[model samples]
Target: MKIIAISGGSGSGKTTAAKQLQQFLGNDDCKILSQDNYYHDHSDKFSGDGSVNFDHPDAIDFHLMAQHLKLLSENKAVEVPIYDFVTHTRKKETIPFKPTKFIIVDGILILSQEILRPHFDFAIFIDIAEETRYSRRLKRDVEERGRHPEGVKIQFDSFVKPMHEMFVQPSRVFATHIAYDNNSLANLFEDLKKDFF
Candidate 1:
């Protein structure tokens, strides 16, 4: 199995890029695992102040994710967790998944960790301007995550941008490809075909 990772800052189009690639690779041959699903359940520790630093790598159960990835690579089935973005916690249920010809892991911080980085055969970083990313994030958060616009802006300024600069941005050096914008996905698709096919 070939493991591919799509990593970028929040709202930088990682999911969009990953879905495009997955479609190109064919649904039957590719299995997608999102790092978002591995978010540690912090609902209990939730403060009314809204100071949760979710963008930090510490928020993820990387050890479990890496273990599951290894198991999948060995042709073993593993149970993947389900996370609730609104509640900021994991659900009790899990879905069983098996390895396939292509494994696409999508998340902002997948490439930021030393252990997870080495497991990827191909890594992509979607680069976007901060203003554009912030705009996209604002829309998505308000629409999907039930967040207020002002709260989104505050969180972005406080945690998201800092975490990206500290961990996500530097991790770009490890990516095999850098996509400047979503328009570049077609070219990236061809490049991936050449590399993987």
Candidate 2:
């Protein structure tokens, strides 16, 4: 199996890129695991004013995610956790994930973690301007995540931007390729299809 990581700051197009890759490679052949699903269950509030730091690397259960990735790499099946952003907790059940020809793990912190970094055969960092990222993030949070605009803006200003600078942006150095635009990301996938297939 070919394991790839698509990582970037929130709303920097990492999830979109992963979905595009899955479409390009075919869903039967490509599988995606999102790091968001591994968020540690917390009863405390996750708002901008809350004490919990969701942007931090400690927010996810990396060890479990790493184990799941390893199993997928070895053609083994695993139960991937299901996290609820609304309730800030993990679901009682997990989604069964089977092995596939391509495993695409997308997350902001995937490349930042030393343990997870070595698991990826290829790494992609979606590079976007902070303004664009913030704009996209604001829309996504408000529309998809049911977040208030004011809270989203406060979080972006407080944690998201700073964490991106501290962890996500720095992780770019570890990526095999950097995608600055959607076209480039598509081209990269086309090139990989030729190389892998």
Candidate 3:
């Protein structure tokens, strides 16, 4: 099985890239493991004032995610955690993830974590302008995550931008490919298909 890590700043289209790759590879041949699901429960720490830095690597349980990846690499199935973004908590039930030909792991901090980095056979970092990222994040947060516009802006300014600079951007050096936009990602898909498939 090949493990692919897709890392980018929030709203940089990491999830979209992963979905496109999965579709290109076929659903039966690939499975996705989202790092967002591994975020540590922040219910008690939720202040809605951007005090909690969710963008930080410490905010996720990388050890558990690594273990799950290891298990999957060994052709073992695992129960992946289910996180509730609305409540900032983990759900009681988990989703069972089976091994496949390819595993696409998407997140802003996945490449930043040392424990998780070595597991990836291929790593991609998506790069985009701050303005584009912020705009996309704002729309997603307000529309999909039920976040207020004001709070999204505050959190982006306080945590996302700085953390992206500190953690996410530096991790770009580890990527085998860096995509700047949808067109780049599409070209990558063609290249990957030619090289791997």
- List lDDT for all candidates, in order: 0.90, 0.89, 0.92
Kindly give the stretch of ten consecutive residues in candidate 1 with the minimal lDDT sum: 45-54
TM-score of each: 0.96, 0.96, 0.97
Off by over 4 Å in 2: 47-51
lDDT winner between candidates 2 and 3: 3
Writing each residue's lDDT as its tens digit, candidate 3 over 141-191 gives: 888878888889899999999999999999999999999989999998888
Index of the highest-lDDT prediction = 3
Superposed model 1: Cα runs more than 4 Å off: 47-49
The positional error of residue 190 in candidate 2, measured at the CA in angstroms, is 1.5
Per-residue lDDT of candidate 2, residues 42-161 (tens digit)? 756665343466889999999999998888878999999998877788999999999999999999999999989879999999999999999999898788877788888888888898
Query: Cα RMSD for candidate 2?
Result: 1.3
Candidate 3, superposed: residue stretches over 4 Å from native: none
* Model 1 residue pairs with clashes: none
Residue lDDT tens for model 1, 1-197: 89999998998988888888999999999989999899999898765344788899999999999999999989999999998878887999999998899999999999988888778999999989889889999899889888888788888999999999999999999999899976687898898888877
Task: State the weakest 10-residue window (summed lDDT) of model 2.
Answer: 43-52
Model 3 worst lDDT run, 10 consecutive residues: 45-54
The lDDT-based order of candidates, best leading, equals 3, 1, 2
Pairs clashing within candidate 2: none
